[model samples]
Target: MDVNTRHVLIAGGGYVGMYAAFRLQKSLRKEIRRGEVTITVVEPRSYMTYQPFLPEAAAGNLEPRHVVVPLRRVLPDVQVITGRVVGIDHAEHTARIDPRDGAAYDVHYDELVVALGSVARTLPIPGLAERAIGFKQVEEAIQLRNHVLDRLDVAESTTNEETRRRALSFVFVGGGYAGVEALAELEDMARYACRYYRNFRAEDMRWVLVEAAGRILPEVGEDMGRYTVERLRKRHIDVKLNTMLESCVDGHVELSDGTRLDSDTIVWTAGVKANPVLAESDLPRDDKGRLPTEPDLRVVGAEHVWAAGDCAAVPDLTGPPNAVCSPSAQHAVRQAKVLGDNVARALKGRLLQNYEHKHVGSVASLGLHKGVAQVYGIKLRGWPAWFMHRTYHVSRMPTLNRKVRIVADWTLGLFFPREIVSLGSLQRPREEFERSALPRQFSPPASRSPELESAHAGGRPEQDGK
Candidate 1:
């Protein structure tokens, strides 16, 4: 392999991909400058979302844009392609790229990093796909915020009790950090928004968290989980444990515990599975559909291919003998550093290092000035945990510019009330315009031209024949 002019193609622009490219660009600065190495990153979005702040974004505590790092702006030295990798031919070291509505093309690479992060793992729940929304991206977060506020608007405008109740009811599935934080933050926002509505009170809103498991926040331990449940219960939010959503047909929720709820909004945050693009590739994946990787983050049995983050089943040397790394922002960020260095080492013909980081504790923000955290075996709750959650995540969010912007948002939020204006029209932006431009029968009658009026009357206007 030629040391000069070697191309490194990275799939997915999530935390792992972005960090890996960021590190590689810095580590291989000389090679990049000398035209010895080229780093290319392909992803559907132009920005990398810092998912830790997604809950806050939904709660109006953080700007949606500030929670995402623009890939091109952050990695100017790297080639950032706004496209999706449809297939990966490992044997040929080529990737099939679809530039989103454009013709597909293939790109060759000497080294390939498969960081295609996981997508929301969904089950065949009735009415799930159509009625429920997933809390995964910035768009979803923004949409959910608007949706919650829109529901409040509906409830306030409706006179029917059932309609009002349904509009104010929200059901959230999954008990993990994503589910818990999202529920707590949104509940807080809804409660605050109630102050603006004369008919809607904080108690009028029904926030239900249903987890199939016995407890929530399993990462923070059973103690914290129990405390979180209690705290939520105190806030009048229903915490249903060991509960399965039997069906959510048309937003009418049926639970395994024989309880039925009429909710307009259902947020699904259950879990995630590896990106299915791995199946399309010739890469070796494990039973769970994640790429089986060595401790150095290299794909097992593939010399030039590497994998990391949620899509890779990396052996956990720091834990039990057969344990694999869990999918989390903490692990992904740490793994990217090691993976990036190893890729640089491979290109320069140097010895590679192993990735053996132990699982640090977790922090979860419950709401404004409220949270629970377990860091370095120490447990904290309430204001301390909330402060820690914000501090840790902001420090980790990519780019100093983003960090400052987020902090500024928080600082401003201290003095200002939460913005509850519902921009739900954004979801179907052209609806109003389309409705207005509908057929004449559907639209209101308007003054017509004299010729058009004459034609409509089924007669010609009087004309002189000379």
Candidate 2:
């Protein structure tokens, strides 16, 4: 790389980072080919995962691989580094990065874009750390599928009613889009699986939603949120609003509302907090630990440093002074485009434009052919909303190839039933193999008494008196 070349370093490879990098590569193609500008992306993962399709991945509607876009393949000209950017020295114009498996190095950059995404926010409640599972990653989706199946197997094999009841009860905490959609999709899958087993029935299992707030799906407003609660209740799901999980010790879940329920699985999906890396930087930040950026998306105090996505608190022009953009993909994806354009403009000494966008409503899938959506002040429910949810996200999914594959999955679903095979034993495959390899230790080896052996050889057994 030449000293005269404009070097841009993007801190993340998520929805914002990856998309922004792609735009940068395309916009600066001639400049990069002539050694006028260079782009480097530093992220822990090499692929960008589209999180909107995660619920369908959990429900077995779409393959997990289709949701991730490979950064190298998409941005052929840009340099993609698999590492973690730990800190930044803005005054020195250097970024501290810890490579995937090596020592730290200082990457010199003319401009920086901080797109580090948020992490799952957790509470300090007892037993939550050990008992609760999160729905953030693709791994969690796979694990939850196995767990649900494992519970089904336990319920199918056991004769103890108490054990069976506890095994069948599933509790989900938080009522946000993630929490509600995950619970709804998984419940739909589990209910469909009961037909294969003799002892299991849809009514036998309990699906409970525990939210600290009085309503669910706050994005859809009060009326629709209430409607969602009522619809779920009609399906025999126990919706406990304004209830907190006091404890979930070893399979027993106790609530603040005096209801004690025993369950095998607990999922936590309250909300998310920005990644903690922002605190180490010299850049200005808001009260919520988010980088303070100008309306043009440049970091306020740092030269050539820009921030967007969940890590940056971009001002909401449509809202009050204290309000910032909500940390969602809708904002991140759009803001990233503007951020990338401004980055290129900064290199050429052009004027940067301010980023002002209004909230485009939200949509969420709630199981098969069921959903809730609010877009441009219009509210929709049932199949129409679900169709809109799928259509909108599918359009936004990474590439055309992935969009085709996802649509194919939905098209196939119309003709065929879902595959609900619970591979719970997958988590403990080693234990299963060990049990098969080793002999039982509780009983002695088989042996033959002389009299029994003789009787088997056609001789009569001898009496003690004889």
User: 1-466 in candidate 1: lDDT tens per residue?
Assistant: 3545999999999999999999999999999988999999999999999999999999999999999999999898999999999999989989999996779999999999999999999999999998999999999999999999999999999889999999999999999999999999999999988988987788988999999999999999999999999999999999999999889989999999998989999999998999999999888989999999999998999879999999999999989888999999999999999999999999999999999988889999999999999999999999999999999999899888999999999999989888889999999999999988887654325876776778777978666782
User: Using Cα atoms with residue i matched to residue i, what is each candidate's TM-score against the true structure?
Assistant: 0.93, 0.91
Determine which window of 10 residues in candidate 2 has minimal summed lDDT: 440-449
lDDT of 2 at 302: 82
Q: What residue pairs clash in candidate 2, if any at all? A: none
The candidate that achieves the highest lDDT relative to the unseen native structure:
1
Worst 10 residues of 1 by lDDT: 440-449
RMSD of 2: 4.6
Residue ranges of candidate 1 with Cα displaced over 4 Å: 1-4, 439-466
Highest-scoring model, TM-score: 1
Q: Give per-residue CA lDDT, model 2, range 1-466, as digits (tens).
A: 6878889999999988998898888888999999999999998988888887788888888887888888999999999999999998888888899999979999999889999988888889888999999997777888998898889989999999998999999999999999899999989888888898899799999999999998999988887898889888988999999999999989799999999989999999988988888778777877888888889998888878889998998989988986789888889889999998888787778998888889989988889999998998999999999999999888888789889988888889889988888766667779878978898776423686878877877999899999
Candidate 1, after superposition: displacement of residue 318 in Å? 1.4
